[model samples]
Target: MASCSNSNELLSELVCSVCLELFQDAATLECGHSFCKSCLDRKWDSEKNSICPKCRALISERKYMRNNVLSNMADRAREMQIKGETNEKTQIKPSDLSQRAEVGNTDHFCKEHSEKLKLFCKEDETPICYTCVDSLKHCGHNFIPLHDAVSIYKEKLTEAKFPLETHLNEIEELQEKQMQRISEVNDQTKAMELHIKSEFATLHAFLQNKEQQLIQKLREEKERTLKEMEENLRCIKEFSDTIQTQMHDIQSWLEQNDALHILQNITAIENLLTRSQKNFIKSSPKLVKHGITLGVYKGPLQYGIWKEMLSVINPGLTSITFDPNTAHPNLELCEDFTRVKNSGIYQRPLTDSPEQFSLCACVLGLEAFTTGRHYWEVEVGQNNSVWDVGVTQASSNRRGNIQISPKNGYWTVSLRQGILYTASDSACEALSAKPQKMGVYLDYEGGQVSFYDAGDMVHLYTFTCEFNEKLHPYFYPGLKGSAPLKLFHLCL
Candidate 1:
């Protein structure tokens, strides 16, 4: 009875505190506490931080070992308890003690047949005794030794984990690259901002220098005109003095008492009068003040400056011309290739090539751009009610009727029936004024295609895309009008 009491006390110590039951699949923590593997996992999962269940010590790392010794002892303790409850005897026999000792030697036994589990059912994936092989539940199931099954499954698990590890490594590498790219973008933005500021500063300095030059020129002109007027004033003073001297001489002669002296001086006076009249007519010319004007500076000051700014601009405009090789059959290209007009009739016996457009009345530019900024203007006459202007990828279809949109590698805006619309599924907003001349600006690296009114400098529309190939300037001059589409160099 004392031994039995001692066994009961040991069993209580093996029980799990969380589930209040015998520990199944016992696991031991670093803090020397033990619990069922599942119970401890549940406790840790519900908490933000893992800790020992008994002592509540912080578990920095969730590393635990399976308590194999504790697991065996628990199994024996359970069996012993079950046997003791079924057979109540006050005194313990030697055979009973021997049997109790034998129970601790093996790990698991069949619940129904009380035989050691030695075989694993491959189909059922459960440990079973030899007696269970012929049982109805597992009669036809495939079986292997428990030890061999464990080894095989461990190898399979390791094999499966290799691809997962490789995938994880690849994902981590890509994540690092993405982070580096983000940093590079920020750095580039800062550098670009500084460059913009520096460019504007240069422009400001140029304008300031021009203003000083104009002011200096105006000052010099004023000084020259004033000096000429001063010379004219000196001439007038000299002439006045001569006239006063003549009048005085004549007055003195008139006061002479002798009639003979007066008569003799009359001839001299007449000669002097003739000479004075001739000198008066020739000398002392009247100074008519001419109105001063600022010349071209006074007319279209901003426009003049803007035009002059073209010289300083890094890239003023792209001179684009038509590519006759890509022109449609109904299109007529000028000798210079800068102009295209629809002939209203298809030209026959034309040399056909893969680059030629067979359906749409379209013509591509002679130059193709793959990088940097480019801007060009096309003059679509106001009388032409239908026209199209923009850019298209070099690989875009030229054989059939193509829908002009970004999806089709064509970024364009078209006018139909006197109304303008973007070359997409939707219509663009009404412009303030119709654009007779359309400007196309392409920022290849920036992935932007912008349209503007070349006449008024108004923004028409913009298309954003990721360009991966060569892009060409696109033009479509409808057959309804006799107006020819002409390309011109423009300043930004």
Candidate 2:
């Protein structure tokens, strides 16, 4: 009897503290404590920090060494204790112990009737024997075969796990996409930074301050976007972990063959599924990284700055004059070649030159610009019934009837009858008012041509295109207009 008690004490020592079960596949931690390998692993995985379950020591490295000696001792102790043998040095293999554990106990019997519990009592929420069904204690309770009850509960658990599995998959996919987006964001930010730096490096000295402002703004935007993406990733991971734990619990419940145990807390399980469904709907995480834009930094950026610089620098307009050689027969130029008008009759001794306009009463500027910025003004009579003033490409047609459009390498604003119209591929757009003193500004490298009312410098219209050839200032004094088109004094 004393030996049996000692044997029980030895068996207790072999039991793992975490699971309170005889150690199976035992593992030793760095802290010199032992536990069932699966128990230790589950504990560590569920916790944020890894620590020894017995000693409470923080585990720096997760190395689980299999304790072969302890495992063999635990198997021998469990086998001898179960078989009521008091042999301390008895040899028992792990497989022998596993086979003994696989053998299940007999079905439980009702204490009062001493009969097998084969029926489930729905009202009492427990298994009862056949004799107990007619007893006054269970007189009015509903009952079903134990097998049927197990089947029903297991089916319900199985059905509930499907949505949880799908929800977990979606969250995992979102996590992968979010990680990819983070990498892409970094690449895009670096590329944009280089582009901005190169652009600002070419700008004037005064723009150094503006360059710093833009860089700072870009950094702030990147920080904000990354923060949002990371937060979304965290949320997705947290929800994914929650679903995984719930599904694990449900699977365990479904694997149970015992009717009474499987049906226990059935209402709580249904409530859990309901909560998961609601949370799945509400906890949808999205990756939100808005694209950064240059805003005012784009589209006629340099031109706008140059306009601002004009006030401080006080740079004057460019000096430009009409090329009389390119004038039509009926167009007469002033002695200074600064003004032109369409005379009623054609001049004698007709000269048909390639540079001359044969049909339209138009004249080209003496200067041909292929690069840099140029701004010139032309004065038209306030009540001029018909006139055209803008820039045209040097290669454009100057002979016969021609369409004054961008396709023909011409960009002009004209007045027909009494309304002002700007030419385009689709159709001509009418302007609210005509500019008597018209300002035509051309940015060769910037790919922009803008017109303004020279009187107040109010912007009128602009055209953007890629320039591949030399450009010339064009003028047309309508045949029916009373006033001539005259050039303004030059300023540089």
Candidate 3:
């Protein structure tokens, strides 16, 4: 028994009875025998015996105790190993340290969930914990093991850094370009402002000049009209005085009852009366013959210089006519010739029937004439089939030849020049003569007629006479002579 007891002691010392190896977590069994803590626990469980394995002594089931000293020693060794690994890792360069840190952080705890982030998303390359992996939000998403994913993402991050840096550099370049564009736009805006200001200044000056010219013209016309009115009044008063004198002389002779003296006085009074009557008739008709007058001729006229024939006549000679065969033939008539609403009809030698006849006049200084296009309507008539006649100006000849077709009611004329012409288009014809006074055959209503350039509108000029022949109408320069010209037939 002593020898067996010795052998058992030796065996206990040689091997851990619980672990079956050396006594790594050595502890004493309740029988005062020693064994490893894990091995004894295992033996107790397997045997269903609460007795010491060697001593055969009964042991209480509740007396199992952990060997804290042995556990502490093992914990210390594990700590030393972890520390050695950590120190070795720290020896790596900062760049390598960053790679290690990235892998560590990806498997780190989530800030929001307070759970380990382990599963890595291949798409976004982010780590997710078990909670996130099972979540419906990330269902069907591509994922990989955390460790493997971390290594791959680290390499990707390293590769992406170069492109990211280049992108940042490109961003700076674009910023510079944007700044340059802004500066250029500012400069262009300033230049545009200056140009607009210059144009406005020029326009203002032009308007001022035009205003002055119009004012001057108005003043001159007013003065001339007043003077002519006074002269007409004087002529009317003289005729009245002559009539009164003749009547008084006749009354005195009748009251005397002296036959011889009465006869002599009557004869003398008759002679004086006849002479006075003739003079009065001539002067009175002149007073009643004045017609309406328009302002100066400021528009382009093919021929004829515009002249003020009457005090009220503004600047342009509106119309004129001459014919010897008519009752009122050989007359050169002007509207308001004496400035008394009376017109003057002067008889003159008739012109020979020349091969060609022409008439022209101007409506110069007319404000209605602008840089754009203008239109005019004219009517001409004679006793025979009128040949081709046209209206034209010196500046431009494109809008000249307006024909007055017999089929067309009236001829339309345009003042624009240099327009292209086809077979259907009209060509401008130049006027042969510039006539303040125009000549027409007396076989019919013989007269040259034109429009006056009243700044506000166009006034028609007509020449009519009592004749017995059929009159043919002619229009100088036709636009689309197929259509009747719009007539400004308002009589003043």
Q: Considering every candidate listed, which one attains the maximal TM-score?
A: 2
Q: Once superposed on the true structure, which residue ranges of model 1 sit more than 4 Å away at CA?
A: 1-201, 206-318, 348-352, 489-492
- How does residue 118 of candidate 2 score in lDDT? 89
Tens digits of lDDT, candidate 3, 49-129: 676654456787637455655455444544554577323322222223223233233225543333556566655445666
Whole-model lDDT per candidate: 0.66, 0.73, 0.36
lDDT of 1 by residue, 81-108 (tens): 6677524433233233323333333335
Q: How much lDDT does candidate 2 score?
A: 0.73
Off by over 4 Å in 2: 1-116, 123-126, 129-132, 135-141, 294-492
**Ranking of candidates on TM-score, top first:** 2, 1, 3
Q: Each candidate: RMSD to true structure? A: 42.7, 19.8, 42.6
| Backbone atom clashes (below 3 Å) for every candidate | 0, 2, 32
Model 3 ranges off by over 4 Å: 1-205, 258-267, 273-284, 288-492
Tens-digit per-residue lDDT, 1-492, candidate 2: 555445444555576777667899999988788899999889999999998765457888778789999999988877766786745444333333223322223236554543467898988777788777877788789999988888877787788899888978888988999988888888877876776666556564778776778678778888888898888889889888888888888888877666666655667667766766775678578766444432222223343445656654444544568887888888877788887888867752347677788888888898888987677778987878888888888889988998998889898888777666776633234555666887777778867777766766666677778999999888888874368888753322
Report the error of model 1 at residue 39, Å: 70
Shift of residue 196 alpha carbon in model 2, Å: 1.2
